[model samples]
Target chain A: MNFTRRFTLAGLLAVLLPVSATVAQVDSLPSWNSGSARQAIVDFVGRVTREGNPDFVPVPERIAVFDNDGTLWCEQPEYFQAAFALDSVKAMAPKHPEWKQQEPFKSFLAGDRTALAEQGEQALLTLVTAAHSGKPTDEFSKSVADWFSTARHPRFNRPYNELVYQPMVELLAYLRVSGFKTFIVSGGGVEFMRVWAEKAYGIPPEQVVGSSGVTQYQLDAAGKPSLLKTAKVQFIDDGPGKPSGINMMIGRRPILAFGNSDGDHQMLQWTMAGSGARFAGLVHHTDEVREYAYDRQSKVGKLDEAWDEARAKGWTIVDMKQDWKTIFREKP
Target chain B: MNFTRRFTLAGLLAVLLPVSATVAQVDSLPSWNSGSARQAIVDFVGRVTREGNPDFVPVPERIAVFDNDGTLWCEQPEYFQAAFALDSVKAMAPKHPEWKQQEPFKSFLAGDRTALAEQGEQALLTLVTAAHSGKPTDEFSKSVADWFSTARHPRFNRPYNELVYQPMVELLAYLRVSGFKTFIVSGGGVEFMRVWAEKAYGIPPEQVVGSSGVTQYQLDAAGKPSLLKTAKVQFIDDGPGKPSGINMMIGRRPILAFGNSDGDHQMLQWTMAGSGARFAGLVHHTDEVREYAYDRQSKVGKLDEAWDEARAKGWTIVDMKQDWKTIFREKP
Candidate 1:
C-alpha cells in the first residue's frame, strides 16, 4: 500500500479500535489467552487510568516504552535489522569487490554465520554502517520502506511487517486507548525502524526512539537541502543506554516498559524505579512450534539478567507458549 | 500554580480557545495587531489545516517548534535560566566557600557582570554546571520550580512566568488548537526548561527539547532509583544543533519553526527547506519602551544573521513594536 492508503487504514484502525476497546471490554486484547501475564497488563492499565483511583496517572504522564526486536516482533533466526544489513551488504558487493576479501564481510558473504559471529562487535558495527550509511535520510527511509515492502523472512516467507506479534499490536493499540503514549525505544537504527513502525505498529515516527548515527545537514550540488547519514555513531539505545536514550529523547520517565531481552534490562529498571504506579513486562519466547525459541544462550535477543530480574522484581513475564494464542498477525 | 492546577487550566484553555478561534474569526491572536506578520501566521495555519486544501497537512505532520528564551518570554538583562543559575551559585556558596576565590565564581560572586562577561563561554559553562549538577533529576526539578515560584524579574517585579509574551502564548495555544503539536527547541538546559515549561506554556516536558548534561541512572543505598544530573554537557540545542536536536527528539521535520536571534537561523533554514507547506518566523525585539530592544550589537540575543536571512528568505519578521498590542501577559 502507498503512504496515503496506509495512513488512511491506520486512521480507520485508530478510530475503530478505541471504540471496540470501550464497547467490547472482553476482547480488548483478544490475541492473548486469559493468563497471569495478560491479567497483569490489564490490571496495571486499569489502576493507572481509572479516574479518581489513588494510583491513577494523568494522561500526559502515561508513558509506555517498548523494545522493537523481540518484544514487538520476531528476532530469532537473526534480528530483522541485522538480516536487512546482511542483505544490503550482498546487494552492494558488486560495487565494492574488496568486500569479498574483507575479514567479516568475506565470511558474511560466504554465509559463514559462525565466522562472522566470531569476528565480534567491530565486525557487526562495520556491517551495519556499510549497509545504512552514505545516503540522504529521505533516500535511506525510502530504501528501508522498499525493503520492508519486498523482503521476506526465510522461515516464515512473510514480509517482516507481517512477522509482528498480533497480541503486542493489540497491546499497543490498547495502551494508546488507555491514554498511554507508546514509544519504541530500540537498539535498531532509528531511520530503519521509522520507515515502517507507524504503519505496522500504530506508532508514529515522532514517537519511535532508537539508536542513530551522526547525520550531517547539507545542501547538495543542486542546492537542495538534505540530511546525510554518516558512519559515526551518535547513540546506541540498548542495555543501559536504553534508559539514557529514553531520558534524552523522551525527557519524561516512562511508567510502563516492555521488552524481551537483557537489552531491555535498564529500561524496565528505570521505569519501575519511578514513583507511583508502574508496570514492566518481558515477552518470553517459549513457543518453538509457533516461533523460534532461543533466549539465554542466543546470539540475538539474549534474555538472562533481565529474565532473573523480572522474576525477582515481580515484572510480568509473558510466556509466548502460554500467554499468547497467536504469534504473527493474521492477514486481514 | 501546582502542576495539576496548571494542567487543568491548560485543559480548559485547550477546550475554550478552539471554539473561540472558530467563532471569533476577527481576532485569533488578540495581542497581535492586524498586520502582514499576523496575516502570514493566519494564512499559513489556515492553508495547512483546511480540509481538502492541497497544502493541508495531516494533524500528525503539523509539528511546530519554538525557541523558549526571547521567542516565548523576555530574555533581557540575561536569559531567565542564566539568572536562575546565578542564584543557584549564590545559594550554594556557603558550602563551596572556595568559590569566593575561584576565577569565574569569584567574579560572579563580586556582582561584576562585566567581569563575568569578560570570562566568556568557559565562565558561563562553569556557572551552568555548578548550578545544575550533583542532584537527582526530581530534586533539580523542584529547585527550578521553587525558584520560578518565588523569583521575580528585577525590572518587572513580577514572576518570570508572567513576563512571557502574551501574543506568543496565544499563538502557541492557537497552533495547538489548529492541530499543530508545539515543541520548544531551546538553548537552555532541558531539565531547567522541562521543570516549568508545561506549566508556563502548556507545552509538556516531552515536547520541550533543549541542551542537556549527561545523566546517570543509579540506585541509592535504600534501593531507590534516581537519575542524577552530572556536570558534563551532552548536546547543545542551539544554532546548528537545533535542527539536529529536533530530528533526534521529534524524529520528524517541523512544518513551522519560531525563533529569535542568530541561534535560530539553522532551525528556520531546515524547516523552510522541507518540501511542504512550511513557515518560519523570527521575533524582532523592537519594543524598547515595553521590553528591552537589542538586536545586532546586543550581548544577549544578537539577531544579525537571522535578521538579514529572514528578509532575504521571506521568513516573517515579527516586529514586536509593530505587531503586538501587548507584551507581557497581564495578571488576572
Candidate 2:
C-alpha cells in the first residue's frame, strides 16, 4: 500500500492500543525504566513522532533547548566550568601576585572551599573573572584545552571531561536523530562554553548561547587582535534571560526544555508556555550511591521549588539512579 | 543476474567500447555540444562529484560561502543595506533635529547619491551608524521588516527582497540538495542579515557572519523592560575580516567560495588556499538588458583586480546574460 494508506492504518492501531496496556508494556522496559518517568518519555516521543499525529512537530520546528551543566551532564561538587576556572586560577597564580592579596582569589589560592562558598555568587564571579579575564579568546581557549587534558575530578578520579553523563549524551543523540536541533543555553560564559561544548556535547559553538564578557578588537602596528577584558557582565543567560537569549540568538521558541535546578525553571516555563506539542523534563539527583544526592539543600545544582512544580506540571522527573544504566563512559 | 555478474559485464563492456567513440560520446553532453563554458561546468562537477574520484570531497565538508550583495543579488547604485539605511534615515528624520545639521546626514536628506559617495567609507559608516544605532535589536529588526515590505528597487520597481538572482537561488538550493551547507558571509550588519536571511535564502541566522554593532542588555528600575542596544561598530565583516569571521564564527573553512567583487577576492583566496579540494567562482555581470552590466568601473561592487586574478586562478566566471535562464523572480 501507499504511504497515505499505511499511515492511516498506523494511526488506527495507535488509537486501539489501550493506555493500560501501553503503561504495562513500558513498566517491563528493562532495568533502565523507573516510576512513571520512562512511560512519560516513551509516550511523548511516540505521539509527537507518529507520522500522522496532530502533535507532530515538523522537522524545522523541532528545536530543543537543553541546560548543559546539571541537566545534560553531572554538575556536582561545583559546576564543571567553575571547577575549570578554579583550577585555572591556581595554575596561573605564579604569574600574578595581585591574586594572592585579593579576597576571593586569596581564598581560592589557599584552597579554602568553605571560605570560597562563604563568599557566595559574587566571590565565584570574582574567581572566574580573575582566571578567565585579560587573555585573547584564542589564548583562553588554549588554556582551557591545556587544563582539561590533565585535570581530573577529585572524587571520580577521571578526567573532568569524562565525567559527563552517558545517559544524557545518548538522549541528545536520540533527539537529533528524531529531528531536533539541540542547543546549549546556559549561564556559563559563551567563550568558555564554546571552547569545549562542541567536543563534549556535539553542539557547535554558534548553537551555544550563554553569559558573556565584554570583548574589544584593536589594531596596533602588528595588525588586529580580539581581546577579552575584565568580566563586566554583558548578558546573563539564566532564568528569563534564557528566553531572551533564545529570542535574540535562535529567534525561535524551543519545543523541549531540560533542566535540573531553579535556575532553569524560567526556561522550562517559557518553553512549556509555547502553544504547541511541548515537553519539559527535570533531572532529579536522587541516587546517593551512583551519584551524589541531597538536592533541595545542595549548595550547587539545588532542585528546590522546581521539583514540586515539575511534579504538579507532570514534567518527566529522571531519577538518576533508576533511569540510567551507566552514569559515565565505560572504562576501557 | 546477481551483482557480481552485472559488475563484470559492465567492466567487459567498458573495455570493448572504442576509446575514441567513448570520448566522442562524453563530448556530446547537451550543453557542452553548444558551448565551452557550459562544458567546463559539466566536466568539473562530474569529476569532483564522482564517488570514486580521488578529488571527491565528502558531502558533509562541501561547504560553500557566497557573498550576498553583488554575488547572489544586485547591488547597483548602492549596497542594498545602504539603501535601506537611507530610507530608514528619511523615515526617522522627523524625530531628530541633529540629523538635519549633521554633514553626511544633511547630504543624505538632500538626496544626492554623488554627495553620499563622495563622503566615502567613513561617511557611509557614519550614515549607517546614525540610522541603525541606539535602537533595541528587535525594534531595528521590525524597522527593517517594515522597510523591506514597502521599499522597491529603483530600476526593477520590485520590492528589494524580491530582486534576488533566481539563478543563484537555484544554485544555492541545488548545492544544498547535493550536500553543501551554503552560508552568506556579507558586509551587511549581522543582525540586519539575521532578520530575514532564513526566510529569503534558507540559510539560518547562525550561518550568517557580517558587520556587527555592539549590543547590551539593560533593565529599568521598574523591572518592566529590558532592551538590546545597537550601537557603534563591533566588527566589520569584510576583506581579511571575512576569513577571520568565518574561522571565529563557523569554525570551518569553506571548500567553495563565490563572489562578484574585489571585497570577496580575499575570501575566495582563503578558500583556495586550503590544502585539498577547492573551487572558486565569480559571478560576472554582463547582461544589461535583464540586469545592470557595469563591472570594471562600478562604484559599488567594483570588479577590476579580481577579474584578472580570477583568470589566473582558473576560477569559473559566470556570464550573466549568456548563462542565466532567468534573473529576478518577477522576470518572465
Candidate 3:
C-alpha cells in the first residue's frame, strides 16, 4: 500500500506520457487480461528461465512452437491461405482462359460462396495448385508479398497480417526475450508464409515450418539458379503431419506449444510428451462479437479432439473474450 | 617496427603462457597458416561485416554452410558415416543369424574389404537399414551416441569426432562470433550428424540438412508418442540434391559455402548464384601424413568436375597441407 502511494506521482507522469498510452504498452502481455491464462504463460516462462531451479530449461533447448492460422491470427471466413488461393485464381484467370469455365474456379470467380463451400477443400486445393504452380520461388514470393500488401479481411476490414491477435504477438516477444526460440508451425505453404512472417511476427523465414510444394533447383548456363515450384504437394503439415513436420524441420520436441484447432493436436501432444516442465495451450474462439466462434462444428480450424484432450490433460484453455484485453491490434 | 620493439617484453610473457604461446592467439584463424587462402577468408568476412561497405551483407543473411564429411572431419578410407554403418551391422549381427548368410553382411562381417567394395554403396545401404531401421528416433540417437563414445578412427587411433580439422573448427567459431548463422549441409545421415554435431562443432540438429530415412510418428493408447525410423529412404541430399535440400530445409541461399568433394558442387554453385557478396571454397585434401590426401582420382569424395569448375569460377581452392597450420588438432 505504501509502495502504491509512493508511485502515485509517477503513475500520473506515466499517464501524461504520450507513448505510454495504455497499460499494455508498459508491461509484458499487456494485451492479455490478468487471468490464469496470462499467469500460466508468465509462470511457465519464469519457471523455465529461473537458474538453479529444478525445471530450468537451457536457452538452446527452450523451443516454443505456435500454430499460425487460428492461434496467432484470425482464421475466420477461410484460412488466410485459402483466401490467397482463391484470389490467386482470380489474378491468374486472365492468363488461364480455361479457368474462366472451370468448375471450382468458375464458382470461385462468380463469388458463389455457398457453391464454393459445397465444392469442398479438394476442389479448393485443385484450384490452388493450378493457380500457383510451375513458377520460380522468387516470383511466388513477390506475388505473395504483393497480395499481403493489399489484401484485407472482409470482416475486420484490415490487412490480413494486421489481424494477428495483439496478445499472441506480445506473448511471442515475451517468450523470445525470455530465451525461448519461437517457431511458426502451420499447414500453410512455406513459401507463402516466409514472405511476411518476419515483419508480422518477428519470426524469421528459417524458423517457419509449414506445408511445402515440391520445388526443384535448376541452374541455367548464364549462372542463374531458380528454385521452381511444382504442382505436387511435398508435406501436408496438418493433423498427424504436425509432429512429423516438427521432426523433419525442427528435429527436437518443443517445450511449449499453442493452437486453436484440432489440426494442432499432434503438435501439442508431442510438446507435452517431452520430459521436464512443459506448457500446452489452446486458444478457444469463444467470442462471437470479437471473432468468429467455432468448435467441433466449424469447417475450418476445427477445434474438437484438441479441445477435449487439452481439457483432459489440464492444458491451458484460453477463452478469447475473457483472457484477452484486446483481440486484433486494430482499434475497435 | 617501433610497436614490435615496444611489445617485446609482452611478447616474451605471451610465449610463457601455454594457450597464448602462438601469435595466432592474438587473432582469428590461428590454426590457418598465413597465406592467400587465409587472407581470402579474412578479407571476405571483413568486407561483408564492415558497415556501409559496398560488399557488406546483413547479419541475418550472413549464412555460412559447410559439408560435414571431409570438410570438417576426416572422411578417408571411408566416410565416418560409412564406418558407423559398418560397425552398426556388426553390433546387430548376433540379433539375426540370417545376417551371417547375407551377401554384403557376410563379406562385411568376414572383413573381406575387396568383396564388400565390389558390393558397393547399395549393399552397404541395405545392411545399414537392416541394422538401424524400425527403432524409435531417441533409441537410434542413443545407439549413435554409444558408438561415438567407443569408436576410434583406425588410422588416427582417436575418437572420430576428435579428428576434426582444427582450422575449420576455428573458422566455424569465428563466423558464429561474427553474427553468421552456420549450418551443416552434408550428405551424411541427418540423425547421425545430429547426435555429435553440437558437442563437436557447436551446430544444433535443426541446422543440419542431410539425407534422412522416412520417419513415422505414432501415438499409443497410453498417450505415448514415438517417431519410428523406417527403412525407406527420404532424401539423399547429394550432388544436385544439395541445392534442393537447401531450398526445402533452409529456404534461403547461403552466402558462404565450403565442401571437399563433388557432392557439394551444387551447394557451392547455388550459394555463388545468390546476388551480392558470396564466397564458395573447396578444401583439397593434400596432407597425407596428418590427414588423408584425396581428389579427382579417389572413389570416395571425388573432386574432378568441381575442382575444374572452382578453378574457372575463381572459387578458393584450399590445399590442406599448405593452408592449415594444424590438421587434427592433435600434437605429434
Candidate 4:
C-alpha cells in the first residue's frame, strides 16, 4: 500500500475504534494513578464481564453497592449530611424558639462540638429529628435539593456536589458502561441522599438504600396525597444494618461493595460472601495535603476495623495519597 | 401503481410496522374484550408515550404499580401466600406439636376458615409469623421458589405460577414496551413474592414491594455474612401502608396503579393524586366459571370501598367476566 493510503487507513481506524478500547488506551481511571488499587478494580470488572469466562456474571446480577460519604465524596471535617442538618437547624431555629435554650440544641447552635458530643447520641438524634422532620416529604426533598445547589463545603468553598471524588465517579461510570447497576447504600439519610444522588453519582432514588425516618401517608386540606415526614427513626442503615438494608431494599445480593469505614464492613462482607465472582474495596483517605488524612483514630469515618479486615481478606484498599492522581472533581 | 407493486409495498409496510401497531391491528388486549377499560389503558399509555405532545412523560417517570392477589391472579380460595403459610405450618407440625392445639393454627391446619376468621387478626398473624420466619433470608427464598415450582393450586391443580391473569400479563408487557416500569405492590410477604414475581409477572425482585418481617445481618459459623429472618413484624404493605410502601420503596410516584381490593384503595388514590396524567384501574371479579367471583362480600380480597371509589372517581373497573376473553394463562 502507498504511504498516503496507509495513513488514511490508520486515521479511519482511530476514528472508528470502540469507546471501551479508547478508554483502555487512555488510562480508564484517569484520576486514579497507575497503581495496584486501580489495576485490581479493572481486573475484577474485566473478569466478571468477559463472556464465556468462568467469572462471567450476567448483566442483571452485576450489582455494585457504593457507600456515599467518604467513599464517593469528601466526608472529612464533618459528614456533609450532618452539616446540612446543622444548617437546617439554624434555618428553623426562628420557628422553634425553645431550641435556643434546649440542651443539645443550645450546644449545637453555639457550635460547641465538645459539649454536643458529651450530651450523647440520643441528644444528637433529638436535634436531628427536630431539624429534619415534621414536613411533607416533597418539601424536605426540595429543601435538600436547594441546599445542595447553594451550600458550599467549608474547607473547599465549592458546592457540595462538586466535592465528590473524581476517581470514584469514573469508577461508577466505568461499572455502568460494563452493564453493572450501581447503587448508593450509605449510613446517611435515604431521603436526603436521594435528592442529589441521581445527579451526583448517576444513581436514582430507588437505587439508594440508607438510613430513614418513618413517613406517614396523609392528605392535605385539599385532599392531595402527601407523605408527611415524622420524627420517628425507622431503620439505621449502618454497621450490620447495611446488609439488612440491602436485603430489604434491593432484594438481591450485590456482586461488588465499596466503602471507607467500619460501617461498611458488613456490606463488603455480604457482597464477598455471595456466590460467584465478588469484590470488596475500601478507600483509605491518606492524602493529608490534598484531603484530610485519618485512619484508626479519626472520630469521623473511622477505618480501623475495616482497614485490618481489608488487609486480612486481601480486599482492595485505595490509598488516596498514592493511588489517586486527583481527589475532588475538577471545575468545568 | 401496478397491482404487483402495490402488494409488494403493502408487504414492506407490514414488515416495518411496530409491535404496538401490529398488536392494535390484531388485538392489543387478547384476553381483554374490546371495552372502555382496555381503551383507557391504551389511551393513557399512548398519550404519555407520544413524543412532542403536551401529555408526554419521560420514560423515567412512567411508573406503573399493580396489586398482586386478586388483581394479578385468582385470589378466590385464599391468597396463595396464605395457603403456602398454612401448608408450611402443617409441614412443621411434627416439630411444633403445640401448634395442633393453638387457636389459629388448629383452625388453619384443619381447614376451618370460619373458625380461623373468628380467632381474629392477631391469631392469623401468629400463624403467618410462625410459618414464615426463623430461617436465613436466602433459605426462605429457596423454599418459596421450590414451593412455587412444585406446589399446585388446590382447585385448578396447576402450579400457582401458572394461575396469573393472562390479560394482566399482557398489560404489563404492553406498558413496559411503552417505557413504563412495572412493579408488583402486594400485601403478601416481600420475600415470598420476590421468589416468583419475576418469573410470573416479568417484574424483578427489586420492584416487588410487600409486607415484610424484620431481617438482620448475621455472620454464620463460617464467618460468611447472611441476612437472617427475624420473627419481628416490620411494616404491613397494605391499606394506607400501600402508599407509604410505594413511596419508600419506589421513591417515585406512580403514573398508573392497578388493584382489585380495598387494600389497594389508598395506592390507587395516591397514584391518581400525583400531578400529570394518571390512570387508576380495579379488576372486578365478576366471573364465577372461569375464575371464582367475589367482591364486597368475600372474606379474602374484599373490594368494597375501592369499588365505590372507582365508581365515584370514574376510574376504570374491569368486569372480569365480560371484559376478559380468557382468565388464567393457557397452557403451552
Which is the leading candidate under lDDT?
A: 1
List residue ranges in candidate 4 displaced over 4 A. A1-27, A110-115, B1-28, B100-118
| DockQ (CA atoms), all models | 0.37, 0.10, 0.27, 0.37
lDDT, candidate 2, equals 0.72
lDDT of 3 by residue, A1-332 (tens): 12344246434333233211223244778888888998898888777876567888877899999999999989988889878887887888888788678888888888888988898878877988976688988898898888988998998888888888889988997777666789999998888888888878899888999888777878778878787888977778888788878887788899999999999998999899999999999999989998878999998889999999998889999999999888987553
**What residue runs in model 3 are displaced by over 4 Å at the alpha carbon?**
A1-26, A100-120, B1-25, B101-107, B110-120
- Predicted candidate 4 versus true structure: per-residue lDDT over B11-130, tens digit per residue: 333334442353355444678888898888888877787655678887778999999999998886978887788778887888978877877878887889899879888887788788
For A1-332, candidate 1 gives per-residue lDDT tens digits of: 13354345444443334322452354679998998998899888878866667898877899999999999999879889988887788888899899888888899889998998898999987997898889888888887787888899999999988999999999998888777899999999888888888989999887888888877777668646677788887778888778778877788989999999999998998998878999999999999999978779987999999999899879999999998889989986
How is the predicted docking of candidate 1 categorized under the CAPRI scheme? Answer: acceptable
lDDT per model, in order?
0.85, 0.72, 0.83, 0.84
Q: Is the docking of candidate 3 incorrect, acceptable, medium or high quality?
A: acceptable
Clashing pairs in 1: none
Supply candidate 1's per-residue lDDT for A272: 88
Model 4 compared with the native: what TM-score? 0.91
Per-candidate TM-score against the hidden true structure: 0.91, 0.71, 0.89, 0.91
Q: Where does model 2 exceed 4 Å of error?
A: A1-32, A82-149, A188-241, A262-266, A294-317, A321-325, B1-52, B85-149, B190-196, B211-236, B262-266, B286-289, B293-299, B302-325, B329-332
